[model samples]
Target: MSRMSTPAESLTRPDGSPIRVLVVDDEQTLADLLASALRYEGWEVTTAGTGRAAVRLAQELTPDVIVLDIMLPDFDGMEVMHRIHGHQPNVPVLFLTAKDAVEDRVAGLTAGGDDYVTKPFSLEEVVARLRALLRRSGASAEKPANVLEVGDLRMDEDSHEVWRGEDEIHLTATEFELLRYLMRNPRRVLSKPQILDRVWNYDFGGQANIVELYISYLRRKIDKGREPMIHTMRGVGYVLKPAVAQ
Candidate 1:
């Protein structure tokens, strides 16, 4: 199953600019993953692998929020937060800690960290936490709605409900996830590997067939008796777009 999902609402700064985010983690892969996830929400993201770099970037960007790893090469996240607070006092900080680091969690919160997520956490969880922090800090202007639509098809992410025009549609958990990913990037061709990574959370070896199988499943339910909104691009990939009126 996928660990990430589209946010219900896209948030921006009060000036309608992308919400600036600073992601600080010594683990390059994790940092890049987090940065990608945040950017998908239409936020501007910058990453730093050291506490010193984090402090410097925070000063340069004045990010609306920070995702700081508790462990860093130069210094701990606490010191980075302290250094940054010296300048941008109100910027929200979300700490990343080890799963078993109870002391670190306590210490981080006590040291004025806005929130914390343990390692092995989902991208969705981190995004949700950051959104909450942004709202609490008055740093976000949210465009409201949990529903995603393309053509006459609509999905309510919060309610787990889907509809084709006035008719409701039912889907299995995997099918729902696959459709959600397609809906999220309407009209963009999604390669089999991209679909697998986003919906299944990992590569299925070279078995890109799983993506094809699920795409077929979604097509049967979503386009069986209606104008087809899901299309295949030969060897390229799949795309979802508004159905042309007959």
Candidate 2:
């Protein structure tokens, strides 16, 4: 099960730097999950577990956007936002509130928050919200090409078209997604579990064999009759790299 596809246009700062984000939440697990999701979008993410930490990190990072939880161990998120806004007045904030806490949601927005998400939100929702906030803040004005390339292989993410050297290769949706993941992290070995979570959106459980199946499928289409770009490491995992011409 593939995760939700990101926006077609990759967002970056005017100077082409990764978008900076600050995530503040007392729940360590939730904070880590949000940070992972944001980093997957190619943004820089910093996490803080308390209001004081949030304020301090905000000042240090001067982040482009913030995801703040309303309840914190130290002084509450409102106070943290106030202190951060004192120095970074123009930074956008997206608040996290409990699903039943309507008052907290209203207060957060009234207190200058730019957006809010209830608890138990999906990672995709948070990522989408943060992207919208970044766009609205005018912090990310550069839209990088929606293409991935390694050596002579090219993939148009928006068009979902693939090419190997001069030959256009047709791929199924799953094959395209698998190839996209490999192309995104060229030369980096990806374990079966990682591929399952990212591409299949599930735990390993007993499904490791599926990764091998897909790798074989991709190889026949992408590597057959050409210099091989996908390679397996015994007892490790798999990697995709540029083919070395003989």
Candidate 3:
């Protein structure tokens, strides 16, 4: 951690080191883009094009964060996530899936994916989410109280507001709660039941549709015309991930 960092960097190890990230995807171009974006953010970055290679690299050089794609040429991303977890359970995994299907999302969650993003994503959003994840993980990255910035998206927890650059984002009470939860945890998968418990009153007897409706509302407002951030996990729940690779 202290090896590849410096002072003045926002998120770094306690010794003032840059956060290191490993990106796993089959698409060389997409992985390169994400690696470049992360590196530009002052974090050390690496890439792996297959599950086996990803696992091997992670073992040899541990990274603070891992951006994993669900689909892979050798083993699937889910399996790769498992192997990584087997090696290091506490490490955070942010999934890069093609879609927000319930099955894929649940599988990733069950397999221990911390967070994820769908395809055709904005690099800015991906960067923001990664930074936020590092902050939440307390992985010697950033402080929790610090303002979280992902691309143009910014949220000041102390102020309880979100902004896309200079423009402010208007959110309903429920929307605010949902977004807050997602931001707080960053890349961790929050199941529907889990989200309900966290966001709404535990005793409140709301239908699942409430969760679905809120997700739709959030997507429409937060991700419309940009990239899908909040996503659905069929037969499971929802997650906030980065843009998925094609």
Candidate 4:
């Protein structure tokens, strides 16, 4: 029987080291479930069921990212985040809460959280959100180089040049940034919200069509008369990879 693959299985840090993540939730079942899912991405995952434990693990492990629950048995996630923030101010934190109010989300962001996800959320959304945070935080240990290569796609981070195979492609600054993100996570499917957050640097609200427009521009430049690389997962989002063999 063939086994099913998960979204996390396709993700990797540019440096090739396992990305470390600390999961903090008062519910042990939820915490373990999240840790198991993240581990599928080849991440070093640690779980803590209380705020105190969360702070201790955050200090000890120095994880690249954290998924913290808002309600904890001892103290709230905000206090735990404050404590950990003092030690590793640069580390990214994603708040998971059962509360879905707009004010709650705002409060979490105001409290040093990098991202927020409400409860009863899809695990895929959490993973994608964490991946976006990791990228924004520069969790990779490798020094950035002028050039990035994913399959035949190449991007010069300094000169803002792009090439597919031997053909040079011209792109606007926005387009270049978008393509660079795609190249960074070659085979992994990235959601449009994630794209907007990383490439546009803010919430685009209902301007998701912007992503489609830029994707069309990219396809025209890079995929025309060539083995197409950019793919759409219908309702999900886009992915960049080598052309599938016919």
| Highest lDDT model number | 1
lDDT of 1 by residue, 63-151 (tens): 99999998899899999999998888767788898846455555675575766788888898889888867764557874234789899
* Model 4 ranges with Cα > 4 A deviation: 1-5, 8-15, 141-246
The local distance difference test score of each candidate is 0.81, 0.79, 0.71, 0.79
Candidate 1: misplaced stretches above 4 Å? 1-3, 143-246
Q: Candidate 3: minimum summed lDDT over ten consecutive residues — where?
A: 1-10
Residue range 100-202, candidate 4, lDDT tens digits? 6666876776565766777887777778788766655556543345698877888877555688888888664456668888988988999999998888566
Reference-based lDDT, residue 6, model 3 = 29
In angstroms, give how far residue 119 of model 1 lies from its true place: 0.6
- Report the lDDT of model 3 for residue 190: 78
Q: Model 3 — TM-score against the truth?
A: 0.57
What tens digits encode model 2's per-residue C-alpha lDDT throughout 1-246?
125565456778878898999999988988888887788788899999999888889888889999999888878888998999889876888888885655555567557676678887888877877776665455786433488989889998655579999999876445666788899999999999888777645453545776787788789999998889999988889999899642
Better of 1 and 2 by lDDT: 1
RMSD, one per candidate, in order: 14.8, 16.1, 15.2, 11.7
Backbone collision count in every prediction? Answer: 0, 1, 15, 0
How well is each residue in 1-246 modelled by candidate 3, as lDDT tens digits? 012222234677656887879999999988888887777777788899999999999998788889999889999888887888787765677789887566665556445565567787778667656765565455553444558655556777544468865678766434666777886676577777777777653422444555676777778777888867777767777767655542
* Model 1: ten consecutive residues of lowest lDDT: 136-145
Candidate 2: C-alpha lDDT: 0.79
